[model samples]
Target: MSKHWKKLPWIIAGILVLIGLLNPPLLPWILLILVSAAYWFLPRRGLIGPVTLPADDAFLPSQQVQWWYWTGHLFTDDGRRFGFEVVFFSFDAFVIMRDQLVQAAITDVNGQRFEFEEFLRLHLPKRVKDGFDLSSGAGNQVTAVGGDGHDRLHAQIGNYTLDLKLDSTQQPALHYGGDAHPYRFGGYTYYYSRPKMATTGTLTIDGQTFQVTGNSWFDRQYGELFQAIRQGWQWFAIELEDNRQIMLFDFKGNDSSVEKSGSITDANGLTTTLAAHEFEVTVTGEWTSPNTGCTYPSGWEIVVKGEKFTVEPLVKDQELRANHDLWIGPVYWEGACGVGGAVAGQAYVELNGYCKCLAAKLP
Candidate 1:
């Protein structure tokens, strides 16, 4: 047995003796040890038998890819707005490891991008005690609150001199794995978010200054297993004209099966979940990337059950393929979407990892 396992008996015996001396509960302590030993050494009755059912091979891969991610949009009292996106990607194999990237940009109606980048390094805290209450309701759940009375975050890239605060008033609704059926891909993820936030700050990019004012969106997702060869995904978070919010993600598989995914959060904080079969998202336009020699779906026609919407590209050639070998880097799309039965609002779309070389596809 390992050193830790060999010491277990001695440690338990010592604890029993100490407790017996402190109080006249020696009989109870002795009985506890007997029961613990039976559970530890017994075969079928042991505590390590199995808690969860052994997942099939198809499900095991996703179980291994787990991480924590959170992204939120903040809106200030004035017209100024900021967006906060944070993620902690984790893995088990040496080839796979925990990777984190955060991106924050300020854009105005004038088409200026003031951005800041930071890489997360520290571990998330374990518990919160004393004077601490988790900020919940709307869809926001407090995952970790440091003892120092503030959430901790690290910056990896971009501007070095930047400071910001977390606003609890704008917390979104809380939807846990229990609230909805677990999203099954390769593994499972406990995803949640604090959708809208208000950020007040000035970001200067490349010696240019732009004042930012708008609403932001935050998303948090952590799981062990994720698909590697999936063609691409298109995600949309739109704040509609009637103050309702909608989020849509469409994942395309290699077999040409489009997994239409999305969620609708009403103003009353209730969520109407949408699955792949329940929605229709189609690419209406295409942009070929000269850098990667791949074609991307630049425009889209999105029609949810009982609702119709369209997405048009703001910048069709917004591909970062040269820097990153992925086609879903960054682009802008602005279009109007009709929600529910009547209200129509302007929407934005973000597409990532949409292109793979023809050679990459050929055997």
Candidate 2:
């Protein structure tokens, strides 16, 4: 039975019992109220419990396994653009983005068509500081990383669809952090992997196939409240021409106070956390969104401790605004960056919502 459907019987039974106990000849209305309260307040016992995995599971190495994510943005051209993101241990994943009033379709690896239509909406029991708890919308995502060294993915959201295969031969470096000197994000997130994935497949949009050849960055983080409202960040994941990679992020809060920021991983999985002043991020350009009327930092200048590198945008206008909202997310100026003020390698810099101001708080 579906998870949501299973809750219906208990809810109906509670309502019926309350009605019966409220009769005129009953002991009292207060007694009925107390009984109802007991039904609602009793501890949940049975199969429901926190999810757990064995420590030595084979799939434990990949953080992407059995995880769900949401990347939503409101694009002006469409109104609302949302994608359901999921990565499986098998390397199969999918991303589906679409707007209302449209029908989308999903095409699998073999070019098969599947109707992708569904919506899952639920209200929050409490309000959030930045935004309402809102609902976790409806979507479908499936991925599998095969033992033969290949990744497959399929996703469906509204009328959009995304299916592709990623080459797994190019393994990513792994890194681990502990609470003593944990990742700057605050929570315990198993961070690892390559900064880029060479993708070779087709990305179909509304029945049209666009040949795709691009690099994708994959990150998996699971923890409670990894970031606070006061903390603004600037992040960069650069792929160098020398086949090396650089990943860094800095968190800054009020009074220009540096909370915590640094490069957590290097090319070969060796880890290091740079001091606040060891790295710097300077915005070189800005772009304003016509939809949300919000301006985003479009260009940047990055200096990494003793290492020297520069990054620029390939497509600065890569703005996604759908569902009558605006999300000026980073698409980036990525390419081979000169490292150590001499060597060159692939580089990409991301200036998040903080581009509006140093102390800008996100909504």
Q: Write the per-residue lDDT of candidate 2 for residues 273-334, one digit (tens) a residue.
A: 56667877766677764434556666666676666555554434333222212332322111
Q: State which candidate has the highest lDDT.
A: 1
Which segments of candidate 2 are over 4 A away from where they belong? Answer: 4-150, 155-162, 169-190, 194-196, 205-211, 264-271, 322-351, 354-363
Candidate 2 residue-wise lDDT at 40? 78
lDDT of 1 by residue, 1-363 (tens): 565785687587677767777777686868677677756763331011111211110112223343333343333445444343433333334223433222332223223333333233222211223312222122221222221212333222244222334442343444432232233343334344444544334344355544433343444443333553244567776666666677776765655444555677777656667766677777777877554566767666767766766765433444432222332332322222222234565454555565544443222
- The lDDT of each candidate is 0.43, 0.40
Q: Give candidate 1 misplaced runs (Cα > 4 Å).
A: 1-88, 94-98, 101-109, 112-171, 174-185, 206-211, 228-231, 254-258, 320-348, 357-363
Deviation in Å, model 2, residue 260 alpha carbon: 3.7
Deviation of model 2 at 292, angstroms: 1.7
Lowest summed lDDT across 10 adjacent residues in model 1 is found at 50-59
Best by TM-score: 1
State each candidate's clash count: 35, 30
The TM-score between candidate 2 and the true structure equals: 0.54
